[model samples]
Target: MALDKLIGLAMLAVASAVFTYYTIWVFVLPFVDESNILNSFFLPRDYAIKLPFLLLLIAGLGVGTFIGNVLIKKAEKEKLKKSKKSD
Candidate 1:
């Protein structure tokens, strides 16, 4: 249903946001002066702009989130169908 599709998209947005928020472990560290300072990202600066790696990061997260939400929706649909058929 249309509502199911929308729900799936919503789930994907939440998943991607959570992934980006938590996966930056290498980007922040304590400064030498014992103050809070942020470093660059996890990957090396030279590799950050490379098209392949950049695309891989974006595509991997996008595809993984999309597939996960779709699978959940499909399973829920099957469960509903089975319950209705038995009723």
Candidate 2:
């Protein structure tokens, strides 16, 4: 649908903007003078590194939890099936 396409395009645009901002903050700002106005637009330099690492760590934990939950549910289902067969 046209609405879906519009939403997707909007999301893509936002993602692109964030990526460009992050890339500039990480790669370009470091070399810029401390007194420059650009520094005001972003967080401290350390966060550029720490933020991604923290995000990655959180993402890993989320994925691990999801996988574990799925495995637990699967084992429970199998156990139930075996018990039903034994009955």
Candidate lDDT scores, in order, read: 0.67, 0.95
Model 1 regions more than 4 Å off: 1-51
Best by TM-score: 2
- Considering only N, C-alpha and C atoms within 3 Å, which residue pairs clash in candidate 1? none
TM-scores for the candidates = 0.41, 0.87
TM-score of 1: 0.41
Query: What's the count of clashing pairs in each model shown?
Result: 0, 0
lDDT of 1 at 33: 29
lDDT of 2 by residue, 1-87 (tens): 699999999999999999999999988998999999988999998888899999999999999999999999999999999999999
Model 2 lDDT at residue 84: 100
**51-71, model 1: which lDDT tens digit per residue?**
557788899999999999999
Worst 10 residues of 1 by lDDT: 26-35
